[model samples]
Target: MTTWRPDVLGDGYEQLELPLGTDPDGEGEISATLVRYQPPSTDLPDRAVLYVHGFTDYFFQQHLAEHFAARGYRFFALDLRKCGRSRAPGHTPHFVTDLSHYDAELDEALRVVREEVGGGVLLAAHSTGGLVLPLWLDRLRRRPGGVAAAGIVGLVLNSPWFDLQGPSYLRNVGTAAVDIVGRLRPRALIPLPKTEAYGRSLQCDGWRYDLDWKPLTGFPVRFGWLRAVRRGQAVLHRGLDIGVPSLILRSGASRFAPRYDASVDTVDAVLDVRQIARWAGCLGNRTTIVPIDGARHDVFLSTPGPLAEAFRELDLWLEWLDGADEADTSGSRTEADDSDDSDDSATVSVLHRLTGEHA
Candidate 1:
C-alpha cells in the first residue's frame, strides 16, 4: 500500500510512498514515491498532466500543478525510483545505469493516473526527464497496440538534454571511455564542477524547498550514469515520431564553458539550447518551439519577467491545443470567466492566467 503525506512546503502538494517491495533484480526490496496533486474535485477531470523531473531533481513546482488544476485538469508528478522523496538509505539519488528501467515505474504511475483521472494525459518533462519520456514513447509505438501512444495526447519538453554539450571530440572519445569505465566501475564518482549560478538564476536557494529533496549541490555524475544518458541521447538523435503535438521550450542561448558569470541567468548554461531548438521539430507532426529571451534552463522557474512570458507562451500553446483560435497560435488573448460561482473565483483566475487570459 502507498501512504501519502503533505509536502513540507505547504503548497497543496502530497508525497506518496511505495513501501519496500521486491526488487526485480533480487537486489533487495525497493521503495519509491509518487508526488501527486488531484485538484480538489469529485467529478472526473477533462484532462490530466503527468510531470517528470530531471536528473538530480524532484517534483517541487506546486504552482505548475495548481495552474493545470484551475484549467480543469488533474495533475500528478512522480519522483522516479531512487530519486528525491523516493531515495532510500541504500539507494543513490538519480542513479540508473539505463534510462529504460524507468519505463516500469512510469507505466505504473500512468496507470494510477488513468484510473483516478480518466482522461487523456499530457506529458510535461524537464531536462533529463524530457530525454527519457520520448525514447520510452518511441519504443512503446513499436509495440503492437501499446497503451502509451494512445494515452498520451501531447508533450511539453523544458530544455531537454538532447545531445552532449561539450566538444564533438569529447563526446566521441569521452563517451566510449565512460562506457568502459561504467562497465568496470559503475559506482565510481567522476567529479564535475558545480556552480551556484543555476540555483541563483531560479532564486531557489532561500526558498521553501528542502535541501534534501533538491540539494543546493547536485548529485555526482558517475561514468555509468553519463554513459547511460549518452546512450539515450543517441537514440533520440536517431529520431522519434511520437505522433502527438509537442511544445518545446528553451533559453535563447547556451553557455557551457566553466565560468560563473551573470550570463548564466539569462541563458542555458547547462545544456546546448540550440541543439534543443534544432531537434524540436523531430518530436511529431504538430510541434512548436518557443525560445524565451533571458530565460533560465527551466523557463518556468526563471526570473519574474521571463517567467511570466514563459507562462504566457505556455497558455497560448494550450489554447492552440484546444483549437480556440486557429489564427492566433501565440496565445495572447485574455480569458473570459464562464463560471458563475464566486467560490471558484480564485481557481478560475488562475486557470485564465495559465491559459493566457488577463483578468
Candidate 2:
C-alpha cells in the first residue's frame, strides 16, 4: 500500500514515495516520487493519466495536469530515481547504465495508479521519456501478469527522443565511442551544446517554470548515460510493437546552430524532427504523427499559435481513444464545473502566464 501526502508542488496535489529497493550507484537505498493531481472537488477518478518527464526534467507542468483533469483524468507524473524530487545527495542526477533499470519504479507506479484510480490509464511521456515508455510497454505486453493487466490504453509522446541530433556519422560512430569510453569512465561529462537556444525558449516570462529544476543550460550529460540513450535509440531504429495506439508530436523542423538565434523560437532546438518522423512508425500500433509548425521542442510549450494547434491535435487524439474504449468504459466523469474540453488553449496561454516561479 502507498501512503500519500502533500507534495512539493502543493496545490491540491499529493506525492507517493515508491521504494526502489537497492541502488547500483552505491547511493544507500533508492526511491522515486510519483505526484498525483486531483482537483479538490473531484473524487478518485475512473480515468487516469500517468506521465513521465524526460532527462533533466521533472513534473512541473501544472497546466498539463489541469488539461487532463478537465477531461476527467486523475493525472500523475513520475520523478524517476536520481531525478527531480527523488534525487539524493550521493546520486548523480539522472544516471543509469541501462534504460531498462527504470522498470523497477515504472512497475510500482503503475501498480499504485491501478489500485487508486481503478480504471484504464493513458501514458503521457516527454522527450527521453517517449523512448522509455514504449520499450517498457513492449516488454509488458509480452508478459502475462505485468502492466498489461493494468490496462494501459494509449500513449502520447511529446517530442520523443527517437534519434540523436547531428550528422549520420555522429549517431553511428559517436555511439560506438561512448560505448567503449563508458566502460572505462562512465561518469565522464559528455560535452553539450554551448548555445542556450532551447533554454531561452523555455525560460521566458510567458512560461513560468523553475530554473533550478530545469536549468538554463541543462544538467551535464554523462558518458554512461549517453551510451544508454544511444542503445535505446538503436533499439527504436530497429522497430517496436508497444501493443497500444500512440500519438507522437514534433516541431516542423530542427535548428542546431551553435549560437542562440531567433530560429530557436520556431523550431525544435533540442531534437531533429526528421529523426522523429523517420522512427514514428516503429511504435507499431496505429500511430498518429502530428507536426505542428513553429512549435518548440515540447509542443505544449510552444508559442500561442503552435501551442493552440498542439492542444487541438491532443483533443482529437483523446476523442479517438474514448471511442476505442467505449465498449469497456463506464462513461462516467464527475468533473469539476470548469473542467470543459474548450479550456485547453486557455489553460496553455492564460493559466501558464499566471504561473509563478517555484518557491
Candidate 2: regions farther than 4 A off: 145-147, 325-359
lDDT of 2: 0.80
Model 1: pairs clashing at backbone N, Cα or C within 3 Å = 316-331, 335-357
User: What TM-score number comes out for model 1?
Assistant: 0.84
The number of the candidate with the highest lDDT is: 2
- Alpha carbon lDDT at 354, candidate 1: 42
Off by over 4 Å in 1: 1-3, 19-27, 42-44, 147-150, 204-207, 256-261, 324-359
| lDDT (Cα, tens digit) per residue for candidate 2, span 126-192 | 9999999999987887898544575888889999998888888877898899999987788999886
- TM-scores of the models, in the order given: 0.84, 0.88
- Name the Cα RMSD for model 1: 8.7
Give lDDT tens digits, candidate 1, residues 225-321: 7888989888777777665667777776777645456677777867877667556555544566667777888777777777787887777777757
Candidate 1 lDDT score relative to the true structure: 0.72
Which residue pairs show collisions in model 2? none
